[model samples]
Each structure stands twice: as C-alpha cells, then as structure tokens.
Target chain A: MTAWRLIDSGILRAAEHFALNRALLEARRQGGPSTLRFLRFAPSALLGYHQSAEQELRLDACTELGIDIQRRISGGGAIFMDETQFGWELYLDRADLGTRDMSIIARRICEAAARAVSGFGIDARFRPRNDIEVGGRKISGTGGVFDGDALLYQGTLLVEFDVEKMLRILRVPAEKLSGKAIADARDRVASLAELLGFAPPLDEVKARLEQAFGAEFGVTFQPGTPSEGELELYRAALPEIDSPAWINLVGKPRSDLPILEAAKKFPGGLLRAALAFDRPGERIRQAWFTGDMFVNPRRTIADLEAALKNAAGADVAGIVRDFFSTRDCDMLTLTPDDFIMVVHQAMAQAGPERTRP
Target chain B: MTSIGDCLFPDELFYNVDTGIWARREADGTITVGMTSCACSMVGELVAYLPKKVGEHVERNKSLATVESGKWVGPVKAPVGGEIIAVNGAVAAKAAIINADPYGRGWVAKMKPANWDGEAAGLITGAGVRAAFEAKMKADGLSRC
Candidate 1:
C-alpha cells in the first residue's frame, strides 16, 4: 500500500494558504511526501492564476465585505472562498497515477472524489474538465498545477455555500444581480447544507474524502504536519504572495471588456445572457445567463458553459450548435439555436464582426 | 521529421521531450523555444500567455512562461538556463497563434544561452528528436500522428 500524509491546517489567511500550496508542491517534487492536505480560507476572493485582480474582481464590494482578495496557482475563474468551503489538495508524482494525459488524470481523480462525496448521502458525480455536481448544481470545483514529475490538484467542497456573498464578492455588475439575478445564481451552485438541510461536520467530510482517496489509490495516510522544508518554503513565499503587486499582476483596464446583456421572447420563454468577450481573440471569456426557460436535466446550462468555456468568438454559433448537437437535452419548445440567438443579441454591443452568419 | 498522432515533431530541433518543449539554435548562437504540438493538443486552445520578461536569466527546466486554457494555468519550462532576449509579442496579444503554429511564430522566447554547450548535451537534436518522441509516445501507449 502506498503511504500518503494527511494535513489539516485550520483557517489561514489567503496569502498563507497559497504560499503553502507553492511550498508543499515544491517539497513533493523534490521527493518530500505523497500527501493530501485540507485547508480553510479566511473569507477571501481568489482570482485564477493568469487573471488580474483589477479586471476579475469587485474590489469595492470585496473591501466592504471584508473579503480578502488573492490569487491562486491553479487556473480557472475567480471564486469566493471562505470557511464555509473546505479545500483539499493532492500532491503526488505523475508516475503514481500511470498516465501523463492531463485531462484523463483530472477525470480519474475527480471521479474518485465524487465517489467519496456521494458517500455523504448525496448523489455526486464528476462533471467534466473540472467540477463535481449534484443534480446539475456544482458542489465542488477543481484545478491543478504540475512541475516536472510532481502534480498538485486541488478542489473546494462547498459545505455551506453563500450565493449572495459570492455574487457580491465576484465582479458581477451590481445592477445585473439586483433581484432575479440572485435567484438565477441559486439555480447554478449548491452546497452540502442546502442539499442535506444541515452542514455535515467538517471532520466527517474530510474523513470521507480520505477514505475515498485511500481506496482509489490503494494508499493509507497518517495525519501529520508538513515537514520542515515545506514550512521553510511557506515562510519564504508569504511575502511575495501578500504584496499588492503580486495580487495585481497583469493589470488590464476593464474597459477593454464591456459587459453586454441581451434577451428575447421565444416560443419556449424569455432567454437572457451577459457576455464577456476578448475583442482581440474574439473568444468568449465568460457568459452567464438568466431567463425563464424550461430545460430538463437541469445541468445542461452549466454543462453548456463548460463546453463553451474559452470558445473562439468566431465559432460561437458553431460551438453552440455543436454543443446542442452532441447532447440530448429537452428544452421544450426552445431549440439550442435560440440560446445562441439570445446570447448573440447580448453580444451586439461588440459590433457586427462578432455576429457572423 | 516524424508525425505522431498528427503532431509534428521535427528531428532538427533539440527537444526535452518529457516536458514537450523544444529549442532551436539561431544563426546568432541564441536559442528559440516553444511548446510541442502535443502540448497544444493536450491543453486545447491557449487563451492567455505570460512569459518571463526579456533579459531575465532562467534556469534549465524552469518556467520560461505560463499559459492558460480552460482556466488551467501552468508554465512552459525553459530547456536551458540563459538570458531571455525577446518574447513573442504577437502570441502575447493573441495566444491562439501559439496553438496554430507552435514552432514558428508561436515560439515563446529567444534566449542567449548561459551554457549552450553544457545544456545542449542533454537535449536531443537531428533525427534524435523525432525518435525520442516516438519512443515516448509508444511507451505512453499513444498512437502515431
């Protein structure tokens, strides 16, 4: 059986948490330990690795709410992390998994974690490139980083989520989420407390994850503290992570990206969407929609977003068409093309160049 | 030249195949580096790229740049320690260019090697780049391009 170390570090400042991420991954790459760590964030807003703080977040809201804004080593959209969510990170050599394919590896680990999450009496499954969901609502989101043979994959388990807080902390324009927008977000994400009517004990959730990983990888973990080397790196990386420049890396004006929203009355219902486009790349950076539409297998919209993530603007129609073409979802009277038409209507502000035939 | 799984791995450039990165020697004795085609296919369309600044010295096998796809961000390690001379400004402005042409306009950086002779000893070149990649793919249970 493989030996893995388990670390449970209580609530930590955003900088310290991220610093440990860098430190532990480095140590493991240098042959430190095959480990799993559990961490908690001190109410914070974390931006993806490549994203600039000014561009992706609402600094005023975050400051007013007392949410610490930071950056993560993994790539993905910005997220609001707090003690309500539990973070689990895995550090291991690539050889340990027997596959060098990044996507395949992500799927494998996510499936294992989903299995463990399901053990908590809620049905959960791996939703793709990186998310775990229950009934189409995301319960967990994951991402990773690799250096040489070592890899660090991490996920957040939403034990007790706060959708309103998340909406405030994220850069979603205030006017957009005034009333119905808040309800729309509630439809997208779910937490354990919401599912089971009470937050499961944090320790029990950790145990389930540990047991699931143990069975999947055929390993046993002895709960322990990080080694001296990891602590050393944590100490060294803290200053770099805590500074404003590090958080504000790659400052680009938001004017480069304008928020455009559109809607239309269709046979099925009203469909609305807010589009974020990268003019130069002509790709959709992010899209969120809220409307009265009937679709079965409710996860279809989120899955659509997953499929359309980073889609080339030039290929929006093709991407939307292909997405619906590949999936079997019942949207009642609305066709997948209708969803496309509504999103395009929102993108009209970008100009006719994006409205390709 | 060898094409595996439709990925072109020219045997002419020196490759650190495991990392899926390649380095080519320029006429001025500097080195040009870029990600392998396999890397592009695996990561999908790269939407964002941030390379280390020009003039900085990076160690062999360390990050020369970082790229993002599907919100997954990771680094492209340097194949040899050297002074970074220039970065691809075009790719910086439009990252899909790297996925479109990894070896040519997509090249990440130009470097003045600090130990070209010593580091070059470890990197494969000529037909060796293609063969090494072929062997790697075979061992990884991959199909030919």
Candidate 2:
C-alpha cells in the first residue's frame, strides 16, 4: 500500500496558513510526496482568490471584531472562520486522484470527507459543487487550487459554528440578520455540536478523516511533519502571502455586486427574494428566499439558491423549472412561477428595467 | 473550422493541446491568444478573469490569464514565450464573454512573440489539430464537448 505523510498544525494565523497553502502546493508540484494536513485558524475572514474583499466582506464589522482578513489560494466565496472550525487539506499530484476533471476530484474527496463526518452517527453526504451536508444543512464547505501537476484541496468542518457572527462578518443583505433570518440561517448550516448535542474531541475527528481518506485512496497515512524544504519554501512565501497586496489582489467596484430585493403577496402567503447579482458577469452570485411562503421541506429554498448560484440570466427560468420539477416540494397555492417572478423582479431592480416572462 | 465533436478548432490557428489554448498569428508580428471551445465547456461560465498586465513577459506554459468559474480558478497558459501587448477589455468587463464567444471578442490577450518561429514548430495546427485534441480528451477522460 502506498504510504502518505500526515501533518497536524495545531493553530496558525491566517497569513501563516495561507503561506503554507502556497508552499505545500508548490512543493507537491515539484514532486514532493502526497500529504494530508489538519489545520486550525485564529478568527479570520477569508476571501477566495478571485474575490474582492471589499465586495464580499464587512470590513468595519471585521475590524471591530478583531478578525484578520486574508485571501485563500483556492477558489470559492468568502467565508468567516475561526478556532471553532478546523480545516483539512490534501496536496497531491493530479495522477494521485486518478482524474483531471475538477468535479470528479471534488466528489471523490467530498464523499470521503462525508463518510468521516457520518462516523459521528449523523448522516452526511457530499452535496453538488463542493459541500458536505447533513439532511440538506451544510456542515462543511470545500474548495481547491491547482498549480502545474499538483493541487491543494481543502475543506472546513464546523465543529461549533457561529451563524450570527458569520452573518455579521459577511456583507449579506442587511435584512438577513433579523431573528427570522438567523433562524433560517441556522436551519441551513449544521454543526457537530448541534447535530450530535456536543462537539467531538478534535483528535477523534482527525482520526476519522484519516481513516476515511486512507480507505478511499488505498494508502496508509504515516504521521509526519513538514519537510525542511517545505519549511524553507513557507518562509519564502510568507513575505508575499502575508502582505496587504495579496489580500487586496482583486479589486472591483461595489456597484458591480448589488443586493436587490423584491416581495409579492401570493394566495398562500407573501414571498420574498433577495439576489446578489453580478452585473458584469450577468449572473446570479447568490439568492435568499424568505417570507410567509409555505413549503413542506424547509431546505427547498436553500437547494433552489444553490441551483441558481452562478446561473446565467437566460438560463434562470430553465434552471428554476428543472429544480422544482426534479424535487417534490409541496407549496400550497404557491407555484414555482411565483418564485421565479420574485427573483426576476429582484434582479430587474439592479439596472435599466428588463423584463422576463 | 475543424472540429472534434462540438468543439471548434480553427484550422488557421496553432494550438497547445496540453493547455487547451490557441494562438492566432496576426498580420502584424503580434499573436492573439484565447481558450478553445473545449476549455470553455470544461469550466462552465466564467465569472472572473485576471490577465497579466500588458508589457509583462510570460514564459511558454506559464499563465497568461487567470479565470474563475463555478468557484474553480485556473490559469490560461501562454503557448509561447512573449510579452503581453494587450488584453481584451470586453472579457475584463464581462467574463462570461469568454464562454459565449471564446474565439472572437472573447480572446484573452495579444502578445508580441519573442520566438514564434522556434515555438510555433511545437504547436499543432491544420489537419493535426483534431487528432491531437482527441487524444488529449481521451487521456483526460473527457467526453465530447
């Protein structure tokens, strides 16, 4: 059986963690051995490599709360992380995963991670794109970055997530912070403490992940430390990754991303939708549904939001239609078209009025 | 235009199959670079694009531009060593253009090649484009675009 090195970094500042990300991925690209790393971070708000921190984060709130702002080497949306959550990362050649397709690689890793999370006696499954969830509530979010032939895939497990703090840190629509919105947020994000009534020991969680990954890759994980070469590379990378230039690498006007909202009264109840529209991309970056609308499964809105993320303007109808058709959502006196109309109205509020049927 | 399945490979362009990018030699000494249709299909609709600044020298196989789609970020590598002369403003303002029309208005960058004659010999074109990309797709386990 192939043997892989395992490194457990107790807790590091955001800059140090990002520096390690660059160092480890670069080392693996230069033919280093495959490694599995466990890491924790001090309170930090991380932006995806391509994100503009100003557009995605509440800088004032983050500053008041003493959260370090950093950008990840990987691609994904902004996230608020702290000691309450832990991270797992894998550095391996593309050949090690046996696939060059990003989606397949994501699935393989997420499924294995899901199995690890399920070991806690709660059902967890790999959601599409890159998330692991329990009963439609996200428990872990993942993303990755690749260089040459090597890649670094990482995910965070929320042991005791703070939904309120996260909502405050992220620049979500302000209305999303109300009691009802917070309750809705709680319904969509699951935590180990909430799921199992208590958080498991950190070592136990790490062991579960190690075992699951070993079984998936048919390899034995031998506990190890960062090689001297990797440490040297980390030292070299620190100056760049730790700099402000790296944090503000991608800057865009706030006008490009506008949060627009619309609401309408339906026979069943009032339906409301708030959309974060990317005007330049002409796509929906995110969507949130709230109101008195009655749906049997509470997660239907979250699922719909996931489906609509990054959706092109022209494809919204087809995507929403397909989403509703595939699932059994019981909406009393509320048709899927109603949901589509509200979203369209919200998006229309962004710029010059353009109507879609 | 030459095609393998639904992916278009213009017969006039030189391609680096490994990087899924194409280079078109213009009337001037400059070359225009862009991702092929297959590359766009592989990465869904692009949400963000960041190209190397003009006048910056880039080595062959190094990134000319970085693009993000579906939360996946990756580079569009240069097929030959060159100094970037210009980047597409249209793509910068609306990255989805890269997915909608990768060959025309969606071209990523224009570069003045430092060694076109030498590097051009390594790139595939004309009758060889289809087969080279087919082999790459097979090796990558990718289906027809």
Candidate 3:
C-alpha cells in the first residue's frame, strides 16, 4: 500500500554495482528501505557466489575483451554483462508480502517483470525458475538473495546485440559454437536491436520496468538515493569483492563436472550437444547443442536448456516431456525423446558409467 | 498415510511437522532425516548444498545443513537432537536430487539419536502426519502439491 523507493544507478563498474547489492540488501533487512533499482554493468563477467571462475569462464578471452570478471552474491550460473544489457533489481521486506513461499515470490516478481518487458511490443513471458523470454528466446535472466526479512531480485535485459562477445567470455560449449555453430546462437537470443532495429534509451526502458512493477505491487515509486548506512556497508564490502579469493570462492575440480558430448544422425538432421553435468546431483548444470536440427521457432533448444536448469536426475525424462508437450515445435521426424536420449548417453560417460539394465 | 493440502504424507515416517522434516528410525537405533516435499517446493530449485560433518552433534531445530535455491540460501534445521552418523555426500554434490526424489536417495543425513524414545513420542506418524501437514499447508495458504 505504501510507495516504494526507486534508485537508478546508470552504468556502474561491476564492483560498485555489486557493492550496492550488498549495501541495499543489508539496509532492507535492517528495515532501511523498500525500493526498486535499475542498474547497468560496465562490461563485466559476473559469476554466481558459489561458482568458480576457473571452471565457468575462459579467463584468457575475458582478459582480451577487457571484461571485469566478478562474482555476484546471489546463486546461479555465470553471465556476461556489459552496457548492451540493462539490470533491474528490487529490495523488499518479507512481512510486507502475504506469502512466505520462495517460489511463489519468484513467480510473482518474474511475472511482473515479464509484463514490463512485454510493454516493449514483444510477447515477453516469465518461464519458470527465472528467465524472461520472447517466443522461447531468452531476453532476460534473473536471480536473487534474502537476508532476514529483506529480499533482493535482480535481472539482465539484452537491449542490443553481441553473440560473439558472450561466446568468447563464457567457456560456453566452445566446440559447438565454432563456425556455423556461432550462427545458431542468433536464433537463441534476441535483442532490442534485432527486434526493433535500434537500442531503446535507458531511461525509457527503466520507466517501463518501474511502471510494470509498480502496477503489479499497487505501489508508486518515489525517487531516492542510498542511505548513509548503505554507503558504509558499500565501503566495507568493496575490498572483499575486489579480491581474487572472492572471484574464485567456490573452486571445485573441473573433473567433478565433466563436459560430455553426444550426437545422433536423426531423420531430420544431425543433432549434437556438449553437456556439463553435476554427476552427483544428476542434474545438467549447463547444456549446448549444435548441428542440423530443424525446429521451427528456432529458440527451442535454449528454451529447453532454461527449462531443464536445476532439474532432478530422475526428472529429466519428465522435464523433456513436459517441455515438448506444452508447445508445438516442428522437430520434423525427430522427437523430444531423441534429445533426452542423446543427453543421457553423454551424461552416462562422465559419471560412474551406468550400464543399461 | 496423511494428506495435507493434497500432498501425500506417508504415516510410517516420523515427522517434526513444526520444522517440515521427517525422520525414520533404523533397526540399529540410528535415524535418517530429510526435508519434506512441501519444504522443497517452497524453496524452489536448489543450486548448492552444504551439510555438517558426520559425527557432529546437532541440537533439535538447529541447522544441520545449508542450501541455496533461486539465489536465496538458508539452513535446513535438524528435526530431532542427535549426532550425525553419516551425510549424503552424493546429494551434497548435486542438490537438485533432494527435490527429485526427496523421500528416497535424497535423504540428507543419518543420525544416532541422543534420545530416540523421548523425541520419537512427540513426532507425528502415518495418519497424524497427514493432519499436521494439512494444517500447516492451510495456514501457509498452499494448495495441493
């Protein structure tokens, strides 16, 4: 019922922006502010708090590209961020909302964001876990964190185009993205430049996001700045964030997560993939497929990977089924089951090696 | 079996309904513990899991493990007092398994109960498990699983 504070820090360096993340979250948890913030990263490769830079990114490429590689306080996969993207975040109190369920909270906020993105004349929708997409191509990806009663949810919006740069920075499924494979990426990601033929102004984008979030929560935004306490915390957290240990905090063995590759000559064409799996979790941490598979509405594979993120080992079959059952895609003579089989075969090689019973 | 907000609760499992976790006593006198599906669903997809070392004593309702899901990380409290006999190292590496088969291989830890008879009496089982969870779900405004 009350108005929420709005803070827009336009194009800050990675450390400054992440420090604000720490500052604002702490402030909100201690009952400092209930606000919405729009932020931008000045060419940075941000990794999740628990992710290892050595395992997740190609440091050489990042260094050559002059990208600032830092870790986010939140959880999830690493992302390549820069001025070409817009970041939006929200800080709220738990008691101010009715539900205590985390997934419900995520869905509600993500739906609101999707509505905001849709305002730009694209059919943007929230696709579970955390992502905003246009016709199955991811336009935005989000993640968050909470401390005591305070919560922060942040997202990245692709306003312009840059497929090669992202491929260079992230280890990606490198072998798959070479040559024509790079062209395949064009179908998986969409930018305002590609969709609208030009990048929209930052202010206009922020206004649409603010309007959508405000309408969803039935609150107005009053322009504001960080509190003094937040400034203090920002100063304190800066040193830790800039350290090498902070960037490579969760260094685990790459062998723990081996990249398994598999391919099949199907009736449609050749379909192949390189999968990075959490053998113990039986979950596919990341997946990239390239080759010749004619699926209409080209973003099908990206959507499938997004849907399968954090999926249970025993649930992969079901996830694949649900993903295909919900929508119609012209896989020609190839079925979704074919996709699952290929992935499972590759996964089998990485772990203790499961034999068919 | 118990039914809460349309979710199934096997009455055979010993449950600390207040904490949203379950325990099962083994013939050797140790107990196995895990988070309920309702708890997992509430948290969303887990990205990371960290469990206490085996042989460590854990107080009832105190955190025995920590988990991160959808970027929010927090602790999973122990349902009953005991010394952890073993941790599920497999699931620790792949936290999402805790969601897929929460009641099966997803079990978080095994504990040698400090006061099994005393604590066990207070836990809900079978029919009572369903009722207690039903009440919790209703209070939490949750529908069926």
Q: Score the docking of each candidate (DockQ).
A: 0.52, 0.49, 0.34
* lDDT, candidate 1, at A33: 91
Per-residue CA lDDT of model 3 for A177-266, tens digit only, reads 476656766667788678878888888898999999999889999999998889999999999887886776677776666677999988
User: Candidate 1, which CAPRI tier?
Assistant: medium
| Cα shift from native, residue A318, model 3 (Å) | 2.5
Q: Quote the true-contact fraction of every model.
A: 0.52, 0.47, 0.53
TM-score of every candidate: 0.94, 0.95, 0.81
Error of 1 at B119 (Å): 2.3
lDDT of candidates 1 onward, in order: 0.83, 0.88, 0.80
Q: What value does the TM-score of chain B take for model 3?
A: 0.91
lDDT of 1: 0.83
Name the regions of candidate 1 deviating beyond 4 angstroms: A173-175, A352-357, B135-145
Model 2: CA > 4 A from native = A174-176, A353-357, B135-145
- Please give the lDDT score at residue A264 for candidate 2: 99
For candidate 2, what is the DockQ-based docking class? Answer: acceptable
Instruction: Name the weakest run of 10 consecutive residues (lDDT summed) in model 3 chain A.
Output: A348-357
Clashing pairs in 3: A281-B94, B2-B130, B11-B126
Clashes of each: 6, 0, 3
